[model samples]
Target: MTGGATVTGEGRTREPRDAVRARLVDVAVHLLRDRGPDAVTTRAVAAAAGVQAPTIYRLFGDKDGLLDAVAERAADDFVAAKAQAARAEAHRGADPVKDLRAAFWAQVEFGVANPEVFRLLGDPARVLRSGAAQAGRAVLQARVHRVALTGRLRVPEGRCVDMVQSAGTGVVQTLLATPVPDRDPHLVGAMWDALVAAVLVDGAGSADGSGAAEPTASATFVAFRALAPQLPGLTGAERALLVDWLARAETAAVQD
Candidate 1:
């Protein structure tokens, strides 16, 4: 009977608020994965978590809110796993383009496997404003930036990010639209190859790895843009101005 918990009939402290929240999300995620989204009603999750129905409302506002929490947790874990995998691949001298392509395929797998969360989080307006969505995009952008740093990217990083994000979403939706038995397993690889062709120069992949490359005219600006925050002898305003210039230069070079 303290700050965020209570004592049960046996004088043992009840679960902490955070632990209870995690338990609810765990149950909801299992329901989502096993029984589908429609089965994750507030009452169902509450009963699954061994809590009063009102406890769900108090913690998550409503069933929709609970779903959001579940999805957000899923998104965070997904991003973290991707990041760890990327680091491991980087150590293995993986080509940046290949790494990005692998990431794209994994993302497609995620989307298709979690149809309910995919649909819930896919709302345009919600994606625009969601922290989870933004974090996911940040991972994509970082992978693109790695490609840029390798001098393999032909387009500006930002433009490349938009294209990849749009393409991945389309691939996911198209795959999900088809019946499970009829879904095309080759769709993701074919789409990824086409996307890579559009965004990378011929002979674009690097064996020098993710560390560095002989900077192309465009990649020079891209590289500098990534380092803008860490540039010495620059005030914050100067750093901002440097990034803006680099972005403009990179965009113009790609557009030309």
Candidate 2:
């Protein structure tokens, strides 16, 4: 919770603070989804949640604070979902490589399915200053490092991990910006496959084996594919951070 105001009266409203906070968050999320981030405001949230605006301000310090809280909640939800999905997949005797691929795809799918939640979690300004944001990044980076060290993927000196992460962001962002009705699952799948292939094939040479070639979209795909196997090892928080980064990248690309 971001804003909390002190009460002067001995017998203030008896509403449970947690319940009120939850309601406000729910309202904010709804508004954000239906109307965009700019649509969320103290007065709007309070009215929707059936609470006073001052209560909202008190629960969350300000609009930014409320946004941060909402993002935090979304991150928590994302992590829990990923963890559950990972556990189920692991129980099914999934290959680490396959598991990582599924996880990445799941993230992208979720973002597309829930654009409002994605926007809240992916907003760069809000994420950068959030504790949830920092934790999420650290988790992903650690997973990448771990998988590389385990030799699950051919990540060299952690460079491949960085490359894969960057490429993944590009892929997800591109997906987010494209109109949903116009999006082709086959094209998205192809992009992910291409990314995986480029990263997995161990060669300094280009796809065609020509001399050192300029990095193209195909090359980036290869870089990520090489690192995909290690992605599942990342913590839920880390996965969230990675997703957020991708979302932010997509936002930037759309603006450009």
Best by lDDT: 1
lDDT string for model 1 (1-256, tens) is: 5887889999988889888899999999999989898899888998999999998888889887887888788887888898788778778977777788788879888998888888867877667767878988887887887777666677777788998888888999998899989988888878877886678765564323343334456666666777678889999999998888888898887767
lDDT (Cα atoms) of all candidates against the true structure? 0.81, 0.62
> 1-256, model 2: which lDDT tens digit per residue?
1246444467554566887888898888778878888789888998888878999779888888888888888777777666666657556754444555555566677677777777677777877777765654554454444333333333342454555455555666777888878776776467656665544333222223332333433334334433544597788777677656644443443234
Q: Can you give the lDDT of residue 154 in candidate 1?
A: 72
**TM-score (C-alpha, index-matched) for candidate 1:** 0.82
**What is the lDDT for 80 in model 1?**
83
Candidate 1 runs further than 4 Å off = 1-5, 8-13, 91-93, 125-129, 205-242
What overall lDDT, based on C-alpha atoms, would model 1 receive against the true structure? 0.81
Give the Å shift of residue 21 in candidate 1.
Answer: 1.7
Report the Cα RMSD per candidate: 3.8, 11.4
